[model samples]
Target: MTILLTVLGIALFAFGLLFSIAWHELGHLSTAKLFGIRVPQYMVGFGPTIWSRVRGETEYGIKAIPAGGYIRMIGMFPPGEDGRLEARSTSPWRGMIEDARSAAFEELRPGDEDRLFYTRKPWKRVIVMFAGPFMNLVLAVAIFLGVAMTYGFATQTTEVAGVQKCVIAQSENRDNCAAGDPVSPARAAGLKAGDRITAFDGRPVKDWATLSDRIRDTIGPATLTVVRDGKEQVLHATLAKNMVARKDADGEVVPGKFVPAGYLGFAAKTEIVPLSLGASVDRMGDMIQNGVESVIAIPQKVPDLWNAAFGDGERKADSPVGVVGAARISGEVMNLDQPTTNLVAMFLMLLAGFNLSLFLFNMLPLLPLDGGHIAGALWESLRRNIAKVFRRPDPGPFDVAKLMPVAYVVAGLFIGFTLLVLVADIVNPVRIT
Candidate 1:
């Protein structure tokens, strides 16, 4: 049963991935058609064609490899400097450039002269290229906000889960109280498990964050108004200064960081709680920022990935995951001993994270990616505006085809890195368990 469930989860993720790829390509296709660019091929996945059908000017199809997808726009590059498409060359580098140029013009129909992609204005071209990544971004934000605002997240509440027997500095790292340790303030003040804190000192406490902040800000006397057995009670205690783990804005402890703060010596209860639209937006922003940082940190993680795959080293929890690794995680998530709703939410979150990664990854301004084309268009716009201001001749569209050689190198490096990650994922896969 577990194995079957794992396979089902993997299959579900595969479907989600295909849908994401199709959605991404649909953005480019729609925008390109809207701008009157002639698209000859709209393909999901790469490698040999599995199935296809020609519809009007476009050939829509699915390919054998399910990794990535693309839509081939006619005359993606402008003609050469001489105002004519260059002939095939025998030199290797020249051949690379010519092949790309030829592919861009492969299905060029007679009327396509005006329908060529490069014939569009620079800003329009930017929109056409940017649309793909933007689709993924939209999907990510929608999923994240849906799960957060509708279903809520597991969050800390002001109710006490447990009270400490004695005060122990977090730096000490041991929960067991020593014989000479001071009695915990909460215990001494008659605070018990299941006590719901209604207020702190003179301030009304609506949530755990408010109460925690108030407790941390004071080192001496504080008043806690609690509700227990449907009755309210006020308790007084002297908070002690102690080394404690620092928490982030999300109320999660920052690993390896400690600070001196007033200690209350009790654990806050956690509950599944929904968030407001503003809070949801704030969380989405944080996710985007973290996603950017994770993408930036990929190069640095290569060594660790290599060690984990080939050596006896333990795999780091933050290790980069490929599709295979992510699918495996999805499988594990499905098999977790949790409620069905929680499992479904986890799966949706996984898909959302994958979409976010796709958005961030393709936005790197390097060749063969959507951002690379967008960058070229922006540069062309910049240069043309400068020429217009100086009353100079129009420079025309930037010859992005000239960057074919560099694009080839970038593509090769990406392929190599992907293979490395594949090997690592198979050998030392990251697990939710």
Candidate 2:
């Protein structure tokens, strides 16, 4: 039964990812069509066409690769030898220059000059190029808002419901707590389960963040104030170095033991923030921004994120994941017996976050990306205006073909990074508990 559920979940996740990719491409296709740009092919995925059909001068189909999709607009870049301008009867030099100009435009079909993408104004071109990433961003916002409305936002509160009996600590020596070892500080301080922590180190804790900040800043020993069974007590405890196996964000492992300095063997109490409609929207926006920032910082701060997550720095290569990982996680979520609404809410948030990352990553201004095209269009527009001011001929559109080498480098890096993440995901799959 679990296996079946897992399979189902995986399938659903793959479908969702594919749908998202298709939706992103659709944004470009629709906008281009709206602006009267000719779209010859609307393909989901890359490589050779797996299934396709010609309809009204467009070949709409699915490709073999399921990674991403694209709309082939005539005149996406400057013209080449095979472009329309080259076929015209003209001098060799004139033909060469016109060919370059034509290649700059996405191509229209033979005798279909009316539908050419290059015929559109620069602003319209910009709109068509921006639509894909814009659609992804919109999808993220909607997903986040939906999840927030359904589950409410998890908020930290000062009221603690439980204390840790055994905590994981970092140590090269044998004295550190191992797996299943009882947390020494809480035990030594006579703390028990169901204790309500009210303060730490003489500071009134209003939330987990405040308590954690205070605890982490304090080194050596500290006093823990807790209320148990209607009685308040102050217990002395010594902070120990924390160590455990963990992975960094780039999926690298940094193995070592370090002290957390001031530490408390306890978990935070979580409450739902009841948000008004406007507040919910605002909160969702904030969440989206934070999500984007985290994705951007992943390469640099992955180690810290891994340490925070697993408690030990053991960077592994397979920590990053692709669609396969998403499918696996979704499958696990679906297979849960009597899954709570909160669990589903968490999954939804995860999806939203993943989508947000996808949106941001694709927006990076590099070749073959939506942002690259947008950048190219903007640069061309700027160049054209500057040229006109100087009474010089337009340099035509930015030549994407000229960026082929750079694009290859980017593609190679992407593939390499992707493979590394895939390995990490397979070796150490992240499980939501």
Candidate 3:
């Protein structure tokens, strides 16, 4: 049964991935058509055609490989310097440019001169290229907000989950009390696990963050008003200075990092609470920031990934995971001994995160990606505006094909990195512990 469930989860993720790819391509197709450009083929995947049909002027199909998809826009690049489409050459660099130029006109037909993608204005070209990544971004935000406001997030409350017997610095990383350790303030004040804190120092405190902030700001003594067994009582205790996990700008505790703060010696209870729109937006911003940071850190992680794949090195939890690893994780999540709603929520969150990563990854201004074309269009726009101001001749559309050689190099490196990640994911997959 577990194995079957795992397969089911993997299948579910595959469907979600295919849908995302098609959705991305749809953005390009719609925008291109809206601008009167001819798109010959709209494909969802790569390799040989598994199913395809010619509709109107375009061939829509689902290909064999589900890795990625594309829309075949006519005249992606302008004619070569000789004022005509170029042919293949013996020189590899020249061949690269020729290949790109050739592909741009592969589906050229009657009346396509005005419908060519390169013939469009630079601003319109930017929108056509940017629409794909923008679609992924929209989907990501929608999914994240839906999951956050529906199934909700586990939030910490002012109710106590546990009371420490003695104060042990968080930097020590040990929960058990040791010899000569100072008695915990909560324990000394007769605080119990089920006690609900109503106020701190005669001020009403509704949530855990406010209470925690007030507690950490004090060093000597504080008053806790708690409701125990239908009776409200005030308890007094002297708080001690101790090392605690430091929080980042987002108020999330950073692991293996500590700072000196007043210790209350109690654990806040956690409950599933639906998020407000403002709170959800804040969390989304934090996610985007973290995603960008993770992308920037990928180069540094290559060595670690190589070691984990072949050597006995431990795969850290923060290590990068590819499509295979993500699918495996989805499978494991489905097999977890939890409620069905919880499992569904976990799956949706994973898909949402995947879409967010897609949006960030494709926005990089490099060749072969959507951002690369957008960058080319913008550069062309800049040069044309400068020429117009100086009253010089219009510099023809930027030949994006000229960058084909560089795009090939980038594509090769990406393929190599992906293969390395695939091996690492299979050999030493990161797991939910």
TM-score of 2: 0.67
How does each model score on TM-score?
0.97, 0.67, 0.97
Whole-model lDDT per candidate: 0.92, 0.69, 0.92
* Ranking 1 against 2 by lDDT, winner: 1
**Candidates ranked by lDDT, best first?**
1, 3, 2
Residue 217 in model 3: lDDT: 86
Residue 66 shift from truth in candidate 1, angstroms:
1.3
The parts of candidate 1 lying over 4 Å away from their true place are 248-252
Per-residue lDDT of candidate 1, residues 1-433 (tens digit): 9999999999999999999999999999999999999888999999999999999989999998889999999988888877888887788888888888888888887777899999899999999999999999999999999999888899899999999999998988898989999999999999999999999996798988888888999999999999999999999999999999999977778988999999989999999898999999998999999999999999999888889888987888888899999999999999999999899889999999999999999999989899899999999999999999999999888999999999999999999889988998899899889
